[model samples]
Target chain A: MSETPLLAVHDLVKHFPLGGGVLSKARAWVRAVDGVSFNVKRGESFGLVGESGCGKTTLGRLILQLIDPTGGSLEFEGQDYTKLSRADMRFMRQRMQIIFQDPYSSLDPRMKVDSIITEPLRATRRVSRAKRREVAVELLERVGLQAVDLDKYPHEFSGGQRQRIGIARALCVRPELIVADEPVSALDVSIQAQIINMMEDLKEDFNLSYIFISHDLSVVEHICDRIAVMYLGAIFELAPTESFSVAPRHPYTRSLLMAVPQPDPHARAKPLSLEGDVPSPIDPPPGCTFHPRCQHTFERCRKERPALVEVTPNHYVACWLHQKGGGKGEPLCE
Target chain B: MEKLLEIDNLSVQFHTPEGVARAVDGVGFDLHRGEILGLVGESGCGKTVTALSILRLISSPPGRIRADRILFEGRNLLDLDAEDLRQIRGQEISMIFQEPLTSLNPVLPIGRQVAEPLMVHRGVTKREAYEEAALWLDHVKIPAARERLNDYPHQLSGGMRQRVMIAMAVVCRPKLLIADEPTTALDVTIQSQILYLILKLKEELGMSVLLITHNLGVVAQMASRVAIMYAGEVVEEAGVMDIFDRPFHPYTQGLLKAMPRLGDRVGRRAGRLNGIAGTVPPLTKVMPGCKFADRCPHMFTLCKEKPPGLFALSDGQHARCWLKDYPERRKAHV
Candidate 1:
């Protein structure tokens, strides 16, 4: 991997205004993704994990240019994606694709597997039917779907199979990068492994970079090279898979790690359940978004929002409790 | 050590347009008092159906509890009338659903939603029920229960709504709780909080819980005993440690291997996900052979010919597989 990032997100912010009326011209804004920054290297998998409604999906969409961010800059392959025209963006989208969470709803019910896979090709340009069919077949085979399955619709196949078709469609344009938003979360556990394995193989085969967005820590740990743990609207921790899983630095990240039910029976219980509900995004609390629920929260935490500072070589954490004031807090960071 | 509930030959079938789908086929299990019995399975494996059956909540038009006996506290739940079933539902066997929003009445206030069961089942006055609702709400750690009491379901976050649901379910002081994928919808951080709250509530009330989830890790953490279901039948049943440590069934082994755990990543080849081949068979397609035979690597002619019944492996371990029946002839060992 090179020093230059393949995809860079800087100060990304997406806010949705809620409950506006004529009388009240402006209502409060729900900070879906607020002041988030991250970068994905070429051929690398960067995971974005958060609870539902934490704006992980919104962030992914922002990166893919599906949803326009209220603020921020997205540079993909060193190109300013946010500045691209509609037509230019359409062409640029050929190099980027997305796989949604629900396979059943994501795919068209009326369209056959072949058409669904080749839709990207069809939209891009006028190609010969035979040539399109050939490309579609190649993609289907690449995703482990048989040629005989071309005639069947999405509803005919199982959840995992449909997801494979979705993958095939994403691969139709030969995208260099793919954004998978909870792709395997809807599938069965046994089937989730198959999808993850297939993604890893495809990444190697196509030399693709993946922005894998999911809530499952175990799944993320299995396949992701680097993971970013998002809370409310901001990233609390970002580290390599092993580091994030073994010795998470952020209090929220640590709590998340301990929360994952380990198969080992002898593993001591250190469950640090965060104290309260995720504060409302519409009217979020001042300072650290996690401080209200954090166990290690102190006076500094409630008043000051910590910046994402590197605690180790690559591990980044945003928590006042981990700040270098050397307050009476126990140092869990190694 | 007292048995709170025992289900015997509980076969639940759903009459769909496709066919009469056997959701739960002759399922039997015992829920001892103050124990957490984890019912583990993939989607469409009837784990949720079994839980719904226990509460007599299966929708009759499509669902039929055929050829089974559900005994709760020595009383046959199957024999109970509509009124009696309704009375027993939240009072003795409350269910916490997978999606709190869908389960909760969106139009009603959080307090009203929580207090409805108390008012309906226990015949508490409006004021008394509201008081109980606020108390239980506080018990579940929903901060500012008084202020949030009048808030609608949509006002609360996923975790908060789930807590509200839990509060409502336990407000009746139910002897048994059926949590159907309660934490699956939430993130790991929030999920831990919910798990912690449930465990605390269970201890305080001395309630036995039937936890339905596909995540084996969760089962290992919470369950004293586990029943591994596949295609509407419990293929393996044993202590949590026994199942995780020495799984007797091929399907159970497959599930364990398929999970890409943090621990399993070490010393393992990259891009190697242990996924079982072939998808789960549709429940409508009844077969004489083992339901998992098509996906089983060690499947033989005998396995494809006849469905293996539960064979006792040890004092408390049982497995339904032909390989278990003939240990000497076992091939393709996990």
Candidate 2:
């Protein structure tokens, strides 16, 4: 394989205009994905994690071009494909697919398992009906389902089985990149484990890249090679899972990690020192979006927006505290 | 510790179109005053159904609840009439749900919603209720509580709406709080804040909390004792440490192993996650043996023939598994 990343998103932005009259311009803009940048290498599972309305979903949708981006670019195989024509974009979409959070709604109630799984195949290319069924059965078995399930409706299956079918549908087109948005969030813990492990194995089997989007920290850390923490439609910290979960540098990341109820009863989380909900995206706090909720915020944090800078090897954070001559976060070596 | 609420042989059945769904079957647990007992299970495992049964929240005709005894402060709640139960509902015990938005009245301002319990239970004047509501909201860490009191449910963010829910649940100073996945809908950071608030209020007010959730992390942090339910039965009951470190039930062990822990990042790939092989059996079907037998790795002749009663392992720990009958025999496999 070449050195080029399978998917590279640079300074991506998506702003939803709101509350405008028929003739008037948009009164306000919801900054859903603001200047986001990341790369998913071939056969890599890159995780994008954030709370609700933090724009993680928007960012994922933007990557698949499921929605139009306000600015920035999506590069596939070192090629800027955003400038491609409609017909060309359809061809590009064949290489990328998305697995949604809601399996119950994502799958059509009227459609049988065969039609649901083979929908992508039918849409993307002209395949024989018998061949589609063959491919569907193969994918179903691969995803831990049986041939009999191909005739059943979604309601007949359990949540876990439905999720497996969802995975099968996502892989039916033989996509190089799969954008899995909270793929396991809707399922049970036991089922979540099964889906995550299967996804990991499938990544190796298909040699595919995944932009795994979820609000779940432990799952993200477990499954992804690289993790990016998003807050208020911006990346606060990005690093490998080993360093990210164990030793988070960014205050937002640390706070998020602290919030997770550790499985061990011996360790109890300290009371949250921070205050207030995330600021309105329509009119976000000036300078740093996180300054209002960060305990370590200073005058500079309120006046100057920090850029993503490397704090350690493979560890990057967009926080003033990590900047030179900034407030205490970590002691720098001479 | 004195028992605040004691449930004995609780069972709930929903008369669905298909058949009788035994949602909660012969389940029992105890919650002492000034303590949190986490009732945990995946979706459809009857943890939520068990909790709802405590308050007689199940509707008639379609739903029916039967219990040998649901004693609260030495009184049998099962015997209480609608009028009598109404008096005890918010004054002695209150419950919070997963989705605060759906639970809260969308048209009503948050202040009124939070203050309603105080007015209904305590017979306090509207003025006094509003005043107390504002204070409680502030206590839950909602910024500018007085200003937010006028905001409708739609106007407030998810975290803020949950704060409103908490304020309402605790404003009456109920001796027992049935928190049904209270923070499940909020972000991780907001979840921590809510948990901290619950702990602090539980400390100050000396309240017993029956915390129901699927997340083990939440149980670890909040619950002193835990009851693991599967397929409408309590598979395991133990202290938090016992559940995590010395679990005896195969189902419990499988769940813990299935979970992707924050500390499991290293050497994760070396071992595949041990997810339970099958989905929880449908409630409509009547299984003669142990409900978890189908998925149990250590299923024996006895487990498939007859259900195992709660086998006492230690003073407070028990497991509903046939292997518990012969600990020595079970030890041989491990």
lDDT top scorer:
2
Docking class of 1: medium
Q: Give the distance in Å from residue B273's predicted Cα in candidate 2 to where it truly belongs.
A: 1.4
Candidate 2: Cα lDDT at A50: 90
Q: What is the TM-score of chain A alone in each candidate?
A: 0.95, 0.96
| Per-candidate TM-score against the hidden true structure | 0.94, 0.96
Once superposed on the true structure, which residue ranges of model 2 sit more than 4 Å away at CA? A325-334, B267-270, B328-334
* Candidate 1 segments whose C-alpha is farther than 4 A from its true place: A1-3, A19-25, A268-270, A321-332, B263-271, B332-334
- Tell me which residue pairs clash in candidate 2: none
Taking the tens digit of each residue's C-alpha lDDT, what string does model 2 give over A101-175? 998998999999999999988987999999999999999999999999999999998878898899899899899
Residue B221 of candidate 1: its Cα lDDT? Answer: 76
lDDT of 2 at B278: 85
Clashes of each: 0, 0
Error of 1 at A224 (Å): 1.5
